[model samples]
Target: MHGTIERLDDSALASARDRAWSIPLDEFDPGDPELFRTDSFWPYFDRLRKEAPVHYCRDSVFGPYWSVTRYNDIMDIETNHAVFSSAASLGGITIRDTPPDFRRESFIAMDQPRHSAQRKTVAPMFTPTHLDQLAINIRKRSAECLDNLPKGEVFDWVDKVSIELTTQMLAVLFDFPWEDRRKLTRWSDIATTLPGPDGLVATEDARQAELMECAAYFKRLWDERINEAPKSDLLSMMAHAEATRDMDPRNFLGNLVLLIVGGNDTTRNTLSGSIYALSRHPDQCRKLLENPGLIDSFVPEVIRWQTPLAHMRRTALEDIEFRGRQIRKGDKVVMWYVSGNRDDEVIDHPYDFIIDRARPRTHLSFGFGIHRCVGIRLAELQLKIIWEEILKRFDNIEVAGEPKRVYSSFVKGYETLPVRIAG
Candidate 1:
């Protein structure tokens, strides 16, 4: 029975892929985990944009969904919040279907009134004045990290730099204990992990246990903050905010997970991706080395090129006709930002990682509409400062081995990227 079940599962997956391939490009399913893991999703997306800007996958590991592949179509869908909902109850913003019993509600997963209220509470953190204050510390940290790198010794850039720097930034944002900062990365990984050897949890049961521990730790912080005076840190801000203060235990844990993952993955992945991209395109790196003034333009281009979060899911709130496609109420609709960034109609030389593009911020990596990445400025700032520090310290940061990519369709990121610096 066990062997039969295993073979049946394999056959079903093979059948699914075969069907996906055999169908018209417009009907192709882009949700396969293997495509993203192998970094071969570009051609599939290229075909989707050229053939079917608005596509649909009748079935996937997640479920039936519509994919808006073109740049304009994605912006249209993202901006039309009235037609499409991001409510947690409907299925929060990822292709992964939120289980009925395991509902985790956060501001990013909410729509309209509540999302506005909750988001307003945290918006101040990214303000120009606030970010300016944060910049000093970010540069200091970036310099220290780069200075400490082992010269000429190959190391996992993902661990040594990407994870370390982002994790440190997260710890400061939450005013979390510096010693326990790495826990933030672990929880972030667990929250987004798929069930497998690469996943943090082996089963749903294990995931729940780890998440509970995450909640318990944060609950203690919540307890401490609630009793104290309102402060500038995220924990205090959320604890005092009218919209989020009275949140249920699950919602509190949900929002905490949301913030951690938001703050961790996007920036970390881009930092790793930037190095890998630059290594592959030496001319671009050389151009940047010649002109450090291009860091502002270079950072956004990397965000576009890397597209850390590949897709964002939305549930249709009402029946609507989008580009001749019939989308019914409660149906899943995904905005494939990864595909849109590469849309040649919008971006010139979309495949190449050019640092000095005339319009660098035109991409949808940070997304469109009110639900755009709240920490986008901070993400950009960190990347810019880190690269500035990197160039000051090293002549060339060479890729030492093939990168080990994360096994997920959602978080387009690296697990390990080996590197050695030349001065």
Candidate 2:
């Protein structure tokens, strides 16, 4: 029965590999967005990890970049920020290069003193004390969403549960208007989407227009909050904070994109992934059902199992030789977190969703170094609460159909996941 399920689960992947081998081994382009959309990029990374851990692609749609496939190699690059810069001036943090005119600066894409100063502005919001206070509300909302799931009826979990929960939390954090909260989701999509026929935007021009609208709307909020006294919400925090208070239009917009995407995508996709993965591994799901105490371990394992963001790009600051490969200055280096999480050398049974792994937290999903996800605690809290509430409410969330994955290589998220609960 397990073998049957496994074969059925990997049918799409089996077909994708057939086409994936058409490209020459040396010229393999792992950044092809279509490979991700079809859920067929696994084999490509597997080959890279074995053949060329520090492989370079001379050409891709996003131009030239190096793929760091192994676990240690990625950490080596991620930790040395002095050598691998995340600045927007040096092409930002995605395989896609930032256009000269459209270049925007956010702390995630900045280095040193400026990055430290800007990061400090929002650091207090994710502290243990603040998260503890937020936990009460998180549990309340999670319960409400899970309890309200329609019994014996199919629904898109990505929209109703995953997107709904993450959207609500973001709204509360930013004190954004409740009715207009979905705009956050739209802007998050726009900010990350590759402009193309197959992707989010039809043209670069339309992408910029939507971004301008996002900037103008936030500018209004900034204008209002700058006059008022300090408050705890993210908008007010930025408005009153010294470093972010006087941000230019582009800088303000860039930070908003970072916050929205960070706050929404990672936790949201993982929520959907938990249900999907559990459905695939009935043994683990049964174990979880029998022992609700496993929620603590289960959450982090799911984050690693579903590596929400596949990779983050960093530009080499100077000419250097890494792993005997000549890496020149101004070169783009991408850390494949998805591949690293599945590296068998570092993780035991790395591909399996082991809910009770001994060291569940040992993965590259949150990344390494100073630029590690600022909202890691908040994300874990949201996932833990949702699953805790889920166990109290339902025995199973059946995967009604194959999930539709997002087309972009950067976001590495679900477009929809159909699920149904028992009556």
Candidate 3:
């Protein structure tokens, strides 16, 4: 039964590859969310990297934008802050542009001195000493969560494990109410979801309403935190810090959404992805079983393979020519980190998931330059600790069905994943 399923999946992917080649280069909209939802977007990016490393789409749902597909080209674009801007006033970091009135400024979407100042407010949370402190709680929660799973029955790994653990971690970081922690998950999903009948919300206005609710909830927390002496939690850090204390309403919400989504999605999806990856590559699973020490290498390889957040966007500050392609000022330039992770030139056998790869951390999953993910060490620690606990408890956890992926090109994640653990 599993072999038949594998064959069918292979045939579908082969068809996708054929279609990707048959379509003209100019007609390709690699940023299409449907492609990511179906996991058929690989071939589109493969073709773009080969033929048009710096290609421009004449039109897309997110409007016309430039794609930098190759690994080195993306690094160049990521580092060139003078030419490429990440300001919220200029559409921010995603391919989709927020309306001018709706735009909010967060540290990741800000450039220069201000970005550093705001980001520094929460920097202490992810330091080595702090992570050592966080590790004990992470392991305790992970062990408890794993021990509670039903054996000899199928369950959604995404909900029962991934979301539960990551949301718990987010609650700890924010010192958020334990009973209301799931609200962080809802707000994280709402912040990134495309509005439609199929999405989290039915319309843009509906989406905004929920986000405003998130803002109000956090504002209450912020009010409470400000009244007290300085604390180590993220909310208290920002409330007491000079850089973030006096932020405007939009900026406050923007930073809130940024921290929420950053804390929630990346770790959540990658936890789910690690299970799915190992289930498909049982040989690597066996190797991991033999040498549990490989958990260190396995953590990063899965992160690179998953490339949790697919792409980051920058607005061209001034007209500039890059790699023989002319880019105009104010153009939305998307650096496809998803493709860069799979670039054959930089990574050996980029398509394969080798758990013990020597240079496992070479991929662009966490991005590059100053704008790289701030919670990177904490993310790795969570994955490593979970897998260590898993190896201690279970011999194997089987993937029972195909994963239902998120319908967003930006947030590469699983909505659900069916799995079973043998009794």
Give the number of the best model, judged by lDDT: 3
Candidate 3: tens digits of C-alpha lDDT, residues 1-423: 011123137789899999999989999999999999999999999999999999999999999999999999999999999999999999999999988988999999999989999999999999999999999999999999999999999999999999999999999999999999999999999999999999999999999999999999999999999999999899999999999999999999999999999999999999999988887777888889999999999999999999999999999999999999999999999999999999999999998989999999999999899999999999999999999999999886888888899999999999999988888
Cα-based TM-score, every candidate: 0.93, 0.96, 0.98
Q: Write the per-residue lDDT of candidate 1 for residues 1-423, one digit (tens) a residue.
A: 000011124565466556545667745679888878777666677767777777788878888998889999999999998989998898899998878777788988988888889888888899999999999999999999988999877889999999999999999999999999999999999998887765778987788789999999988998999999998899999999999899998788888988999999999999999988887777888888889999999999999999999999999989999998889998999999999999999999898889999999999998889999899999999999999898887767778776888888899999998887764
Which window of 10 residues has the lowest lDDT sum in candidate 1?
1-10
- Whichever of 1 and 3 has more lDDT, that candidate is 3
- Taking all chains together, the TM-score of candidate 3 against the true structure is 0.98
Q: Cα-based RMSD of the predictions, in order?
A: 6.5, 2.0, 1.5
129, model 2: CA deviation in Å?
A: 1.0
| lDDT digits (tens) for residues 1-423 of candidate 2 | 011133235566677676555667767989999888877788898878888889899989999899999999999998898889999988899999979899999989999879989988999999999999999999998888877889888899999999999999999999888999999998888888888887678998889999899888888887888899888889899999889999988789889999999999999999988888887888998898899999999999999999999999999999999999999999999999989998999999998889999999999888888889999999999999888888887776788787899997888889998777888
Clashing pairs in 3: none
CA deviation > 4 Å runs, candidate 1: 1-23
Whichever of 1 and 2 has more lDDT, that candidate is 2
Candidates in descending TM-score order:
3, 2, 1
